[model samples]
Structures are given as C-alpha cells and as structure tokens.
Target: MKTLLSTIFSLLILAVPFFAQGQQTLLLVGGGQRPQEALKEWVKANPAKEPKVLIITWASANKKQAYETSIQADLREIGVRQFLFSQDITNSFEKNEFVNNLSQATHIFFSGGSQTLIMNILNSDPQLMNQLQHAYWKNNIPVAGTSAGTAVQAELMITGDTKNLEYGLGFLPKTVIDQHFFKRGREDRLRSFMKQAPGNFTGIGVDEDGSILFKRDPKTKEFNSTVLGSKNIMVIGPEINQFRQEKILRPTLLCSQLF
Candidate 1:
C-alpha cells in the first residue's frame, strides 16, 4: 500500500510538469460489445503512456467466481495487452490490488454488469479514490465504462428505481446513459425518467453491439463523441420538446426542456 501511494504521488507530480509543457489526451468509452480495436487504434495513434486496461469487477455486479473469471478472460482476448483485470475479486486484498493497478494504467475499461456495486466500491475506498481523482485531473487519463459502467458515468445512476434515481459517482455530469436501447424498449421509461430530471442532462441510449468513444482534445478542452458498431446514437436534448410540441403539446410538465 505504501509503495502504491508513493507511485501515485509520483505520477501526479509528473502530470504537473507536463501541463506546463502541454496537455494530455483522455478517452472515455461508454461500454458495449468489443472496444479493443478502438483502444488499440487510440494507443497506436497517441504518444502518451502505453495503453493499459482496468476491468473493474465492481461493475461485473457478481460474486460468483466463474462469472468474474469469464469477464477477465474476455477482456484479455480483446487487446487489453497490459491490464489490471485478473482472477476472482472477493475481498479487500483483491480490491487494493485492483486499485494499485489502476494507478498506473492509462485507460479504464469498465465491464458490463452492475453499476451500484461499482459505485459502492469507489465510495468505500478513500485512499484509492484519492489516487483516481489525482490521476484524472492531473494526468487526464481517459475513463470509460459500459452498460452499468456507462450508467454510473452519469450525474446520478438510476438504481433500478423509476421513482428515485440513485446517486452516482459522477464522471460525466451531462446525463444518464442506457445500454441496449431499442431492443429493450427503454424509450418510454427513459422519456418518463427525464421528466423528473433535475437539470438538462443529455440522455444517451446505445444499442447492443454499440458503443461511444469520447475524444478529449488536449488543445480544445472539449470532449467530442463518436459512435461505433451502430447507427443513430440517440440524444435526448431540447429537440425532445420540439419533438413533443410538433406532435402533441402538453402542459403541467416540470423539467428542463431537452432538444
């Protein structure tokens, strides 16, 4: 643990010196299907640190050893040549090991499964999270999560409750993300869910075998999104209101207008 902390601190210091010189590239992949090719392409193109992967078990949302093992192997085959995902995660020792591994990785790949569980792990670890925050702001290491992982990236995760959206460890503050969009008929529920939204969050729903990769332009400080393996990444923004009014306008709605 001591060794890990020292290492994380050293990375933080390095990021500062580089900032005075220039910016670093950050990638955020909303999980789904296979993202290995994209990762390889990104690393091959970028001159930053070697692309390393972190397959968080927290998102796997499972305690079954067999299930976790399967996820690990699947990720390895996908080009996570250097990674922290391994074996069964059933205790703090394993958790610490994962955190320490995250300290060095340039990329974070969240596997599909449970969002709440992952959020809890992050919430439970103060020291580990401290390292993550430092690594994020100082180094601008790219962060990506798929399915439940993607859900947690939103300002708040909808913890299986339509009445009340649960609190999430916010990464992207704009909106909540839903995976397997069209096939699952999430439109109605998502539409209703947005009605209770506290702010203007872009509701992003992706289909199976689909994903979103965000390009963090070091020079522009803007995160532009690109979709892969599918068509029409649904964006529930202000146009939604125009969509509603253009068809059937209604009153007594309390929420931010989305396009």
Candidate 2:
C-alpha cells in the first residue's frame, strides 16, 4: 500500500510541469517571490536567448535588495540587456535611452519593490514617460510585471492616498492588478479598485506561482489571454459574464471563449 501511495505522489509531482504547459510564462518575484520552482521556470524561459531581453525595474522603494547594480548583475548573468531607468543619460547621450530600449526589447520585465519608486522615476523624467507610453501601445514587445510591478500595469492603482502611496501607470487602461493576491488576502483590496472604476476596469488578483498570458491575434484584431500556474483569474467588470467576454480573458477558457 505504501508503494502504491508513493507511486501516485510521484506521478502527481511529475505532472505539475505538464499542467502549466498552457501558460508560457515567467515569474516576477519581489523582495522575495515565493515558490522557487516558478523562478526556475522563469530562468529557463529567459535563458540567454540572442536578442537578449531587457529589464526595466521601477518598483524599488527601499535601497535594500532593490539596488540597481544588483539587478543589472543578475540580468546580465542571465544574458539580459539590463538598463537602469535612472541611468543611461549623459550630456551628449540620448535622454530617452530607457524608452527606446523599451520599444526595442523582446521582453520587458518590471522587477518588484515599491510601486511608488517607479512612479517617481517616470514622473521625474518626461522622456522616459513618453517612451513607456510608446511601449504600452506597441504590440511587438511583451511586458511582464511582478508584485508592485504588476500593480502599475493597470490604469488605476489601489494605493493608499492618505499616506501618499504611489498611484498607477495606467498602461493597461483596463484594471488594477494586486500581486500576492490570494497569499496576502488582498482580494478585497483588488476589488476596491474595481469598485471605484466599476463597470469599466478589471481587478486582477494573482498569487505567487500564478501567471496570466495576454495574446493578440493580428489578422482578426482579436485577443485572448490565458491563465495558468495557479487559480483562474477573477474578472471584475460590469455584467462581468459579458464583460469577461469583452476583455478579461485567459487560456483556461480559451477553447470556449475564443471559438
């Protein structure tokens, strides 16, 4: 009986990777993103692929593990073209280097930390802001956000205004995303953002080891986003069922929704 139970457990563990095949994704860990397994997959997907992806970390609040030098080192080791948003400018250099790189990047990663810190950099530099504006609209590049990094993708951020918490970047123009969703028990907070923007924007609550894929079809101008690695995403909008059909989409439901 013990042997039978052990075999069953081994099979289940082996099946984990296959189950997540639906999502071709990577993790965006913060000060500490739980689930080392997820990080391993992220490293594998981003391994030294020629064009060498770029990472623009903006959410570093405290100067602890969020140091720019450290992040650049990690990215370079993985063969990524790392550029500190705060650096890259010289008397004769282009002020929008960060922005240009953003547009040209195959994959752009937003590291975790303080969302406000990222907002500060964008606000301080107009050139960078314009470049980000361009990247969000450009379909050629893929944007990956983690933790507070994920929070900025939405049009409205559920930050604390009373204490001067950072707002959002409004790149998504759809919903506010709160990371550590289930783990942090932040579903209610995520819903708050949806409530304020009711019937309009969505609130995405993602737990660690979870991911959502946003895919666009050029010929038909239609898009289908798939979720994997964990629980299905919650779609909050007006007439949510129909609204989900309109925007909030994922791969788990792709067969039925896209067809």
Tens digits of lDDT, candidate 1, 100-144: 786777666565667777666667766765666556556566665
Q: Worst ten-residue run, lDDT, model 2?
A: 3-12
Residue 183 of model 1 has an lDDT of 64
- What TM-score does prediction 1 earn? 0.69
Q: What residue runs in model 2 are displaced by over 4 Å at the alpha carbon? A: 1-49, 63-100, 160-167, 219-221, 239-254
TM-score list, all predictions:
0.69, 0.63
Clashing pairs in 2: 59-114, 225-250, 226-250, 226-251
In model 1, residue pairs whose N, Cα or C atoms come closer than 3 Å (at least 3 residues apart or on different chains), thus clashing, are: 31-145, 31-146, 237-258, 237-259, 238-258, 238-259, 239-259
lDDT of 2 by residue, 108-163 (tens): 66767667667777787777776665554443445566677777765666554333
Local error of candidate 1 at residue 208 (angstroms): 1.0
Task: Return the number of clashes found in candidate 1.
Answer: 7
Cα lDDT, all candidates: 0.52, 0.49
